[model samples]
Target: MELKKKPTKKDNFVFLFKGSPLNDFLYPFKKAANQWVARYIIVTFAIIIRCAVGLGSYSGENQPPNFGDFEYNRHYMEIVTSLPLYQWYLQDLGNSNFMLKFPPLYAYHSFIWGIIGKLINKSWFELNNSIGCQDIDLKSFMRITVLFSELIAYIPSVIIYTRWMGRHYNKAPSIDQTIIAATILFLPDLAIIDHGHFQYNSFLLGIALIALNNLLYDNLALASIFFTLSICFNPMILYYSPIFFFYLLSLCFVPKFNLIRLIYIGVSVLLTFIVIFLPFIYSGGIQLLSHILYTTFPLNFNILHQSYPNFWSMTNHLLNNNIDLSNLKNLSIILTILAISPSCYAIFTNTSKRLLPWCLASCSLSFFLFSFLIDETSVLLPWMPVTLLLNEVDADVISMICWFFNTCLFSLMPLLKKDGLLLQYFVLGVLSNWLMGNLSWVRKFVNIIIPFISQRPNATPVLPHSYSWTATIISFYVTATIILSCDLLQIQPLVEIENFWEISNTFLSTISFGIFYVWLNFKIYTIHSLKAKSD
Candidate 1:
């Protein structure tokens, strides 16, 4: 007969450390009343990981000529806090470069942080003189902001969402929910890019997740409010706007179109925009708001940046074999819309909560793969949905998620290398695979191959892999590793092309991501098909 483990105070503490010495070190917690010891431990571990990554090089660490996003964020702090509200968007700070292009919600956040920064060290956010100022204290302050915001906003929202999902699934074990929360909390790409590479994507992503959570609770009013907040914080989340719109509209179709709920949701969204933008609008009127909007959405920028691994980038490579891309931006938009519509439609008609994440992933991945001017970091958008789906512990789903996660990491590898995060990437890569239980077969295979390659017996795997899942994963990862090694080693270029390796890296990653995107859509379709048949 199978045995069921009885719950005890020590149980939570033991689970917290998974039998690590730390459990004995904190034995007092075993007797404590809180049943959430394991969860708190996971949260603490996640924070420690973020802090460790924060110790590494950040985006635009020392580039004197034009520092990257790190400086851009601090610059925004100075512009918004130092300048008048009317001049926030219109300022020529940083010599018309790194202008305050973000929406007012982000501007307000900067302003709040800027005030704190000025108190800590006035020079940190001082006008042009502070440009490229990589002050240690200031850098620490910036990292802390990202870390704290993630802890308070993103991590908590994910935990809450997962717990709610657990409850919805008929009281699944809290330990399972905690594990899912930790996985999402410690998503390597999100931590490395936002905390290490320097961005506020977590803040925006957190708000969006809360919005989704509210929708799950049937709190349409709160969902609209938070969704508006997300868009205001970062307009890039508009890629998800379609999914939320369709799902919320679908609600109207059911239970006979409740006009009051519809009006409440609409007005809530409308008022959020009005309140957030009122200061900008009042200071400079409609033209000012329009200017800010234009700044936020610079459609005129190149349709395909060299760093992005999207369809246009691959196509541009095929056309010109060079980084300077030329594409019909209008066509890219049309294609993105067409690609996203089916997923949105599926969600609108079916409206399964389980399918919501899949739909959002499809929409965001579609935008990331096909849309114009996608940033390398935009992978985090789709990652939110993928990570949320980790509650599904099926082996196939886990393997697929891991593959996509690795692909996302690989697509951002060049940027991560630029940030000097090679060590952190390796550690997190191995650790993530280990946690996911994706290591065994690859380790055995490595043992089998070591005798032939190194004339050594009983060799251990340097890293774990989901290699047994598919030959395609093995090939893709092997090629990616070779490409990454070449880039890291700065291998000699072919006589014909100066950036042959770089182009090859982008081309390979783009193709791989494109294949992953198609696979994801197929998975979503398969789920829909199963749901249909079951119904």
Candidate 2:
């Protein structure tokens, strides 16, 4: 027999060299050029929306003051700017005694805006005192100020996140990647509008993301400093700091020397503490830290007067006239430690099977799980996993979970607060119980008979990665488009209980929750099945 057509030594060497992935450049890094364009479109739209709201009437000339009225925002802005530390750098807050009225950061920003208004017009006193008046002509500008600050701060986070995520895995983000990034940007429903027309969180959230990204990559000092700076803007972001500390502690046993990294971590913590405490060190720095930490972590339930009534807070309210937190300082610490311990242990042991995405996911989930059950906080939940969950290209599981959650959130847009009841609860009765709020017979009938024929009124997940018609036509995307269209067209909601989509909203929420449960369970089972097969 003739000799087999085997490769020569040179052929084998060239083939082996070419096959190595060591020198390959990550495509996502190159995709940065495209990322920038997409990023612009996303931010520009957000900015324009903010500008519109900023210009829109906060108080209805004819419509009565309701949940999201201009008065609510204006009053809050005034209160925020009145805080002692807010305008410490300026003399205006000093003269006006703004310290007693608002939080430090709130006053600080007001001073800056006041200065701008005065510069553009005639007098500082007139501008500052009458900032919201049409005569001052500053309300529109202030609105723009509040909105742009948030939008601008939030945009840069994607850059670092994209790079770190892309480099770790060395790939361009897929379509799912863009969706995930977009989701993170759009997660907080109220945050967007609140920051858009009346408030600010972009600065704090942006700083928090920077700190987290750095800490994840082992740049502890930079991370700590970034965190400290973020705290100065909004104190509510520190609930997840334990996760970072635990991350640092874990590096102590990296199986290889990382002494420089350890130094960086120590420096980071020290710098953060200094930044946070420098102003109040004389007043009582440690006390300030403890107080801020307690108040900031997950935020106090009552900060927003219309807080989502949770089991704890609602129960507390019933037992007393109000929810008493007189004994909560230590309780909160204990709760946080207990809640975050699993992640800490996993991080320290370097034994977490789900560190990267799970880190963000765990915190995001914890915020939702442990907070006072507000609808607004639900927005932040998806970003945790969506951005960091790029370990495998076929992330069908993650995508499905995100899709369901998006549905639940989108469905909730129409219902916020009305009278004594959260509007969504009533909607649940309608959609889940066929528009019946009280008739048990009808509810029972719907449950017993409808289940056999119709699909449950559930938050349905988008299909997995295949290019099926269903996958391409994301229901949440469709729903969102319709809702946006309705808002633009000033069309009333569909199938209203009173006159709009009533029970259907609640039905969609239930469906979303159901789909998320199923999709998560499926992922858990698939991973286990694969592991079992491999073993």
Candidate 3:
């Protein structure tokens, strides 16, 4: 027999990762040139998937009386373009069906897109007649606008972020970078909401991601500008405001009091807001600004929860009749403040760059879980920061990231179902889990059920501990099964409750979210301690 050669360090390293999920997934792109090609292919595939999803049924497709948000978006565009600048918000306030509730930057965005629509087909955006216009060309034009927004803002941000992280944080290969980008791009919630359900959420999130990318590079001034612009586009970004404020404030005193840096960031933020609101300010002054602010923030105590799978939503059934709305709203505010305090304090004291994403995740999760006036789609806000942590080296962190994403997607099922997106939901969910190497147990279970279906012989478990992963997998399937069975089978509630299944879904999701919130805060504190020790 021939003597076996001694294994080199590189050989051992390669062997160590031979059957690892990332390695297996990237096996095709083993060469640098192939990795480059794979990156472009992945991006192209993502855009194609997005475009395909856009072709599906949107919110309120042919629904009469009061149509859904797609119609609201179209209406906003028409009003912004047709009416004078000063009348935009005023007109929206008067029109109950279509409220221009977003910030002025959104109004500006609507105006730009509206102008494009006018160019494409003048009658589609005609003054009063365009309110409920269901023209095929208009639908295509609107969907294309959302797609273009993703290409211009969201896709580029993810690419730049993953490239930077691959180079610096993990020193990962280009294939790994491409995989990360794919994971973010293929997120089911965003695709469903933006493409299937019809919204420009990706555009706002893209600006926020650019701000986060700036934070990674210590570009404080630019980060401030982009973050302010993101908030101007949608006040929903305020969910992340506390963490940003605490982290950036801590930077001012780190090593020494950097007054100049603070002023620079402040001025950058102020100038950005001023520029975005300049037209409204010039036309209608403080009165217009106040109206915009009120409409945007509208602390309406009337409805405690609107299909949000959060703490308030879970308890709304029991509390709605028992408690006063105003008091309940105040209690929610207090709970949210308490929930976010620890993460903010940790970042304020630690101020490490690595801790920023965790802090952001924690803060946004707190907002989603406890803040009042939340919509189900608001889950995407917290999910955004968690996406940044996918490339973390720790297995537990990776598992938690997967768990968090699943919960976010699960929470939006009711809304997606209402929009007639069940098919897209299931398709995207399976594709995302496969791409991220999650839910391997489910695949194995399916393989066992059908002997002819082949399984990956060397597939790595997402979590090293199979028992914990199994429990999570079972929980997800069970909850999903119960919810779908009730809805699809039209099962009556055992208890005589209206919307029993919806309430149960909200409650179950809130429990998962609550557990995740605790786990994430614990992780943040652990990170702070580790950084302290390293220092």
* Local accuracy of candidate 2 as per-residue lDDT tens digits, 1-535: 8988886543332222121121021223324645565555556654654454344433322233233333333433444344454223233333332222223444456557655655675432342453334433655655666666665655667556755554454343432234335434544443333443244555566667777777657666777777666656554455456556666666655666578777776776677656555664555456654654453343445422432222233344346436566865455446545655555555555523345445445544444434442344443443444444533344354345445434544544443332112333233223322211112234346767666553322211124545652544366467556644654465754423242343334334434444443344344445445645665
- Model 1: colliding residue pairs: none
Winner by lDDT: 3
Candidate 3 clashes between residue pairs 3 or more apart in a chain or in different chains = none
Root-mean-square deviation per candidate: 5.4, 12.0, 3.4
Candidate 3 Cα errors over 4 Å, as ranges: 1-26, 34-36, 301-305, 442-473, 492-497
User: How would you order the candidates by TM-score, starting with the best?
Assistant: 3, 1, 2
- Model 2, global lDDT: 0.46
TM-score of each: 0.88, 0.59, 0.91
Which regions of candidate 2 are displaced past 4 Å? Answer: 1-35, 52-110, 121-137, 173-191, 195-197, 256-263, 276-338, 351-354, 371-395, 403-535
Candidates' C-alpha lDDT: 0.77, 0.46, 0.80
